[model samples]
Target: MNTIVDFQQFNNATLEQVRTRFEEEFGVMTYFMNPAPRPCFNKICMSELHQSQTSLEKMQGEVIANGKVSQANYLVLASDIPGIFNLGGDLSVFGDLIRAKARDHLLAYAKLCVNNVWTFYNMQAPVTTISLVQGQAMGGGFEAALAAHIMVAEKSALMGLPEVLFNLFPGMGALSFLSRKIGMPAAEKMVRSGKIYTGEELYQLGVVDVLAEDGQGQYALNNWIKKNHRSLNSFQAINRAKQRVNPLTIEELYDITEIWVDAALRLDERNLKVMERLVRAQNSKVNSDVAHIQEKQSA
Candidate 1:
């Protein structure tokens, strides 16, 4: 469709102003791709990465926005809603783009967006980054948060790899980054099960760095940034040191993601049904266990 670059609001703004606005609005550092919820307005309305729902140039512009913020060494990414951070890539957009034979360009854009987030994650800035999560952060959305040095969430944020539900898998470097953070077993379980998790459960699994009190995830994020500004460089160094020993490289994982994407494109309705059953069965078991724990606590 139209590949127009909309820099109307940003045309005259200085880089530092953009950075400050990004932090103030997202409680992190970055630009939001989707605006307020308007169902069916656009199927794949993700915030962390630019969704090329229309044209490649528009998508590139989104990444440029993130790049501008990153250069300022302040928070570069943030979501509009406090709880549900991002829903991931838009399947309908994928379907449309593929029909138009735009897969190659789309893949390139996806790589650019993924790399942008990775750069943010690997930044040596003392300002650091954070994800204020209280709701669902699925697929790429979840990956974006995991890339951050710290993921602060309220007890209610549900994080997961739900791409399988859409006949795909986490291709946005999530399979590598998340697996390294939470270890293979937990990571595998998350991918295979596509299980959504409470923020407290994520903390227990070490996916969430800081847990919010009484479901105040945004408040926790602001507080963490205020107290830890000076300590960010040290924190990044320590975390990078640990990441260096990890098994998966971005290249290897990106290949795995491509395999999943190709498979998703080839997925038949029968296979999708089977995946749905697997995810549902896993969710049922987890919910039952959670109920048991709640009962025990009440008793």
Candidate 2:
């Protein structure tokens, strides 16, 4: 289904209005949205379908708003759909732009959203941003999730950076976030393989914090909020210090994207076959090991 996302509407909202609107929308008073405010932190939820220019802009505004609201509480940044979080830069937008030879404009728009998330990640808000995943969070969807300090996934959630499948790479800071959180080896596996994860596996890999069963997710989040509320100053201090000590840089992300894009452009059916073979080989090895252990027990 083609969801019409409106960005312009979101971009036009004043900082204070955005804050109040979000609070009213989510029934959470402790949080608000103020992207421009430096020390803003509070409880909010940033989510959208990201279908059009307006949609993307709205999500961006929501993130900025969350930054403004970051005070003593955390925000939940999620998409409307439980199954498909974000499919990435609107292919429709790119396909039309590319056909019309508006490549530069397309690139500029894409970069704008990417950079906005980068700013969100580095915001000085005492906000503990969490990504709530329900369905398929692929490409930029996965990238946006990575921007948060934590990820909460429903058991049915599927996550991956599948930009390679489209002959592109993660233009956002997804590669950087993945590398920092999961290390280069695992991150490379995720990108090069295009293998997605269930919430269970993601939790095991430390990508998601809570493996919630539908409605229970909010309670888990509330529990997290309660635990963090008393130590807001300390929580912010530790996070800020950690960022200062080992922050993900834009240059590093650019370099990673370039490498992945190069690989993506070269990817074809032949490479997919090779990747499948590698996966089969790895799975076979694992099964063999499991069978051997079973045999020893039986003996």
Q: Give the best candidate by lDDT.
A: 1
lDDT of 1: 0.56
The lDDT for every candidate, in the order shown, is 0.56, 0.54
TM-scores for every predicted model: 0.66, 0.64
Task: Locate the minimum summed-lDDT window of 10 residues in model 2.
Answer: 36-45
lDDT tens digits, residue span 1-299, model 1: 11222334344322211112433322334444333232111323332233221122223223234334222234434554433466555544555455565657556646654654555465533445566665667666687778776788778777788766655677777767777787777788788887888889989988889899855765777777678766766766776777676634557655765675566557665655655564455445546646787899999
Going through the candidates in the order shown, the clash numbers are 7, 22
Q: Write the per-residue lDDT of candidate 2 for residues 169-257, one digit (tens) a residue.
A: 66667667877787879887888777888878888987787778755665776666666667766876887787787777766665555
